[model samples]
Target: MEVTNLVVLPAVLAFFVLCLYFITKVVRLGKHPNLNLPPGRLGWPIVGETFDFMRTMNEGNVLRFIQERVEKYDARVFKTSMFGDPVVVFCGPAGNKFLFSNENKNVQVWWPSSVRKLLRLSLVNKVGDEAKMVRRLLMSFLNAETLRNYLPKMDSIAQRHIDTYWEGKEQVFVYPIVQLYTFELACCLFLSIEDSDHISKLSLKFDEFLKGMIGFPLNIPGTRFHRAMKAADAIRKEIRMILKKRKVDLEEKRASATQDLLSHMLVTSDPSGRFTTEMEIIDNILLLLFAGHDTSRSVLSLVMKYLGQLPHVFEHVLKEQLEISQGKEAGQLLQLEDVQKMKYSWNVASEVMRLSPPVSGAYREAKEDFTYADYNIPKGWKLHWNTGSSHKDPALFSNPETFDASRFEGAGPTPFSYVPFGGGPRMCLGQEFARLEILVFMHNIVKRFKWDLVIPDEKFKYDPMLEPVEGLAIRLHPSHF
Candidate 1:
């Protein structure tokens, strides 16, 4: 009887505690003044609509969740709860402009608790002066000028990647192969981990890490986030091993400070002459891989998908690529000037982004109480944006459903209408890097082979970045063939 009581009592106490937590949140919601806070349901206590949002997103109908609300509420603006905070969503171009323009004034950048937990000390996790300072340091390496020097290296690696992975294969799953390529490139340029075996090991861990990027913040042993946290820790430990060696190498003048991102972070210091701590560098490098790798992979795979479906588009891309290839000899690498000439290919890439943006959008926390579009938004509320809204809005984009690369031909969609990479001051720091990588990838792909997607109308999943459920498989044919 005593043993039974012990088990039952603890269970009852836990249930009671949970009940109280929800009760408190529900009570707080009632106290949350009827302040014209946009029309939307708050869902269950504490969680609010986060589960629904995550579920809808995980299912890959990223726009559907928000669009259902917009259709149910107001097309321009609506309100909801996500990640345990009240959120006001600004829809369309106005939303993009409003949120982006008010980066520091009304709201600031925000990430989910899962992201926060994993990237606590990284640049994206910081705001105000720290964020500015770190962003400046990162941009120094990522900008167009710096990337110009890396172009040939990138071209060489891409060609080698194709030769090693895609050349001998008649058919290959493009997404995974390209993923390996991107991760490998990032390792080479970022950490100087050029060994293929080391990269394969890291890539295995990174795959586990990515699973947690959008999962529930469950830290239990079996959870995705748990596995991801472990993977990140393992990765950081690997980085530390290299960090120690790089320090010795740099001190001996055996490695250039500008050789790779790790070395750059090691040498570059703030106003106080304090270099970033090893942990900070590791965390931010993880963040960079978290941000940079997947977007490029998704874009590359999507480019393949679109080109395969539209032969005319492929022909145009092929012509542009041929011009550049003709300018270079058989084994020569692509130069920055070669990348600059890929205007049409870039346009096609842009169209792919517009149709299926890699990221759905982002979260912003309201810094001050304010009224927007006749709705009262309280302080500490989570403000969010859905780029898909603007990307597919008929009012903002003419025939938004169409895959017309010509849309980017001249003038393009309005200022913030095309926000695949986001907008404003808080825009992606890796924008230039993404451009360089994608254009380089486009150059490599078009010059090498023309391919077709095995699956028609491939379905995509989006924890955040839209990913095809199946790694995009393609039938590769050499340009010479």
Candidate 2:
């Protein structure tokens, strides 16, 4: 009996030792050794402060929730979790610099599960020299000569969209119309497709894909993921067909074919005298389509919302539009010079993006161990930046919450301060394209009609992008010459 008892006691002791080892490992994973995380209410196991954020959105006060945290917690850096990743969120000028700095090689962009599942591409992960090549190709396509060639196409599309879409609705659900129009415009320029019905159908499928980018990742029956996957597949197939036909058309009409961006991309070689592969072509097209459609829409919606709220700003824009319309440039294709001259309008758009950036938060996973704010950020840990919070940081912008276009009057915001287009080597490739599209739409719309909000004093909310949650309800008053 004594021998049996001794044996059983040893087995029990061994089991306890193994359990203790696991507990230590878990603790280490959960806590950073040197980083002093900002103070905040980290609620419930696993959930953290996610519930608080969702509640803020639910109550239509997301900005207030973020501000409350910044006021209460340490400003330079903070910690939170979403979808189980413990993210280190950076705010203030210092935090912004740290996030945008080069010392951290581990830094990478993070995408929400829905976006990841839908787009299946990320600048933070899949990007490399391929992106640089694509960027060069785009630069060539938007140059002085190229822009001149694109003018007729741009004017025709803009005029057609205005005449067809705006002529119908008294007060339109403006966001969807803007999205559809931009997608069509992009398709026409890049794909060289002039069929409106086909383009509209493609845009709807793409919209489904975008919506799927924000939902839970279960691709089963009655799931957003499933629908998004189906939509994405359809878009991919449709694009494949479009590209295939374009290639054949280019082959047949090699000399006489239109000089759109895609044709240029197909013919032009990189410095190495090598052409992009089929996959590269498709990927770049997808990137352009995604970037062109959504980001431009976001800008237009903000312009419309703010114009509705502030009548003086609207008047200024209208006056500029009228001046351009009455000039020799009136009803003519918008020139690169024309857009450059609208400096105030540009500043207004820039300020709106600064105050109400569409993408509120970003995350970069460290590829290597790095240091920031005097803390050792471990490899595999995500370094996140909250653009909404960063935009509102008093250190970055004076009177941060107020909409003041004059802030961009003399020079742009500090590189780190105004990152609506993102900064560094990875800045948006479609920046020029988006700017031109937006300027064209604004110029035409302001010239045609005067706009005001349905409720003169309605507050706007930020959901991914700052938009009037109840839709941009506006009454259109005919402009008097």
Superposing all C-alpha atoms, what RMSD in Å does each candidate have to the true structure? Answer: 2.9, 8.3
Model 2 lowest lDDT segment of ten: 119-128
Residues 277-384, model 2: lDDT tens digits:
665666567667877778788789888888878888888877786676676543467777677777778888888888767655566676777766665666665566
Which stretches of candidate 2 lie above 4 Å from their native place?
A: 1-65, 103-106, 121-124, 142-145, 254-258, 329-331, 456-464
Tell me the tens digit of each residue's lDDT in model 1 across 435-463. 88888878877877888888978888885
lDDT of 2 at 172: 72
Q: TM-scores, in order shown?
A: 0.94, 0.85
Clashing pairs in 1: none
Error of 2 at 19 (Å): 19
lDDT of each: 0.84, 0.68
The alpha-carbon deviation from the true structure for residue 38 of candidate 1, after best TM-score superposition, in angstroms, is 0.9
Judged by whole-model lDDT over C-alpha atoms, candidate 1 comes out at 0.84
